[model samples]
Target: MPESTYPRTALQRGGVPVPPLALGSWNTWDRMSKDEAVALIRRATELDAGFFDIAYYNMGPHAENSRTDILFGEALRASGVDRDGITLCGKLWLWDWPNQGFRQQLVESLGRAGLERFDTVVVGDYGKVPDMPRLVAEVNALISEGLVDSWGINNWQIAHTTQALDEAETQGVVAPVVAQLKYGIARRSMAEGEAYGALFDAGVLTLQASDVFEGGILATGRQPERKVGADVGGIREQIAAIYPEVARVAAGFGVTPAALGIAFCLSNPATANVLFGASRLAQLEQNHAALELALAHGPEVRAALAGCWVDRDVRADGVW
Candidate 1:
C-alpha cells in the first residue's frame, strides 16, 4: 500500500483539522462482526484516517431504529484505540426539529455511543425550510456547552445554508464551517454548482464530500441491491448510462472507479474531507489509494470527469 500523502485541511471558521478522508458508518456497522469493526478502527487510526461519521438512525425513510451506534461504541472501546487521537462527527436529524430539539438529540446520540462529545456534528436534512435563527442559536449553545466542538450542515438548500451563515454572523457566534453534500463523479451539481461553490470560494464554508460513489453504483458499474440516494431530476439512469465512459477514464488512470470517484472529490480546492464507507478491511485499504491518485493525477482526473453528469443541475433534495 502507498503512504498517505494527503495533507490535513483546517476547516473554515472552526479551524477543525481533518484528514482528506473520513470513515462513514451509514449502512456499514451492522454488517460487520465485532472483530471486523475493531480491526477497521485500528487500521484507520494507523493510516491517519481516524475520523468517523456516526449517527443513530431514527428518522426519515432509512430509519430502522438501528443499534449501530452502540455497536460502534463497543468496537471503539474493544479496539483499544486512543479516544483523543480520533475525531467523531455525529448528526442531528431535523425531521422533528423544534419538538425533538438539538439538545435532546445530541444527548441521546452521545449516550447511545457512550461518547463524551463529537468533534463535529452535521445538522441534518429537514422536511421543510428551517428557522435559521433558532438553529444557529442552538448550535452555538452546543459549542459553548462543550457538547460539540464544531458543527456543519447536511443536504440543506442553498438559500437555507446561506441564511445559516448570516444568522450565525448576526448572533455574533460561530458559524457552520462545513457543508456535506452529495459530491462524486456521478453527481456534481449541488456541491460544485454556483450556489455552494460560491460559499466555498468565499471561505465561508468548506466542502465535506458525501455519497461519492452514489451508494456503490458508480464504483461497481451496476445497480446496488439496497436503496440509495434519491434520483433527483431522474438522473440515476443517465448516470448509469455513462458508466462505461467513467470506467474507461478510470482505466486510463490505472485506478478503480472507486478511487477515481474519491480522487475527484479530493481534487477540489474547497473539499475539507471525503467520507467513504467500507464493509471490509480490503475495501478500506483500496480506497486509500484515492489520496495518492488525487495527489499525483488530480488535475487530469478533474478534467476527465468534468464532462460527466453535466445535465444533473438539480437542487439538493431527498431524505439525506
Candidate 2:
C-alpha cells in the first residue's frame, strides 16, 4: 500500500509531507545485518511509513560513535529506494552540537546514508544549546547550504524550545519547525504538562512525537525498566495495570492496544507525526492495520480519545 493509506501526511511546519507514522531506528544498530535493515526500510516505504528517524546519540556504551546514524546510513545506502521519495530525519546529540562541524556531520551522515541531504535534522535532546547564537547560525547555514532541509529540537521541554524559537524569530533566523519528546502512555508530561503548553502557545513545532512503546513498557504490557528512574515507578505500575484495560477498550473499538495508542496520539491537533520502530516487515503491516483502524473510527472518535487522554491523563502516570 502507498503511504497515502497512512493517516495525515501534512507536517505543516516544514512543508514536509511525512506520513503520520514513521520508522524509528534508535539504538538498533549492531543488532541486525545491513541487508536486513535495508530490506526493512524498503518495505516501510511500500507501507507508507517512509519517514525514517535515527540518532547520533552517545548512549554511554550502547550507542556510542553515532551508532544509530551509522547503521541507518548503511540501511539507506542499501535500501534501493529513491532518496527523493523517502524522508530522512536524523538527530544530533549533545556530544556533537554547534561546532560539531554541521556540514561535515551532514557530509558524514550523507556518506553513511548515501544521500545528498537530509530532509530534516533534529537536536537529540534539549541539552544546553551552549552558544545559542552559534547554534542558530549553524542551523540556518545548513538550510541555506541545502545540507539539511528542516531543523528542530527533541527531548527538551518547552521552556528551552520556546526561548530558542523566540530568539531565532527575533534574530530573523530560521526557527525550528519540529519538536519531539519521549511521549507515550507511560510518559504523559510532554503532552499534558509544560512542554505541550509551551509549543502550543508558540506555534513552532509541529510534533514529531516518539516513544510510543515507552521503551518496551507499553509494548510488552509490563513494568518499565528500573533505569527509567525511581520517580516514574508509580507511573510504570499504572501502565502495567492499565495496559490490559486499554487492550479491552481497543477490543471494544475493534482495534489493538497499540492501535489505540497510535490513534490517540494522532488525534491530537498538535501532533503531526507519531514515531514508531519496527524490526520486521510484519510490524509495518501492523502499522498499516493501526492506521486503517484509526481511520475507521474516524477523526471524531480519535479526537475524543485524544481529549480524554489530555484531560484525564488517561493511562499516563503522575497526573494527580
lDDT of 1 by residue, 1-320 (tens): 22446787877654757767888877788879999999999998766578899999898765779888888999999999888878899999889888989999999999999999999999988888888899999988999999998889988888888889889889999889899988888677788788888889999889999988877877888887875676656777788877888899989988888888988999999998999888888887878888889889899998888778644656543222
Q: Stretches of candidate 1 above 4 Å error?
A: 1-4, 315-320
Single out the weakest 10-residue window by summed lDDT for candidate 2. Answer: 310-319
Q: Compared to the true structure, candidate 1 yields what TM-score?
A: 0.94
Error of 2 at 57 (Å): 3.0
Look at candidate 2 and tell me the lDDT of residue 291: 71
Global CA lDDT of candidate 1, please?
0.84
- What TM-score should be assigned to candidate 2? 0.82
Candidate 2 residues lying further than 4 Å off, grouped into runs, are: 1-3, 59-63, 96-101, 126-129, 192-198, 201-203, 223-234, 298-320
Query: Please, what's the RMSD in Å of model 2?
Result: 4.1
- RMSD (Cα, Å) for all candidates, in order, is 2.4, 4.1
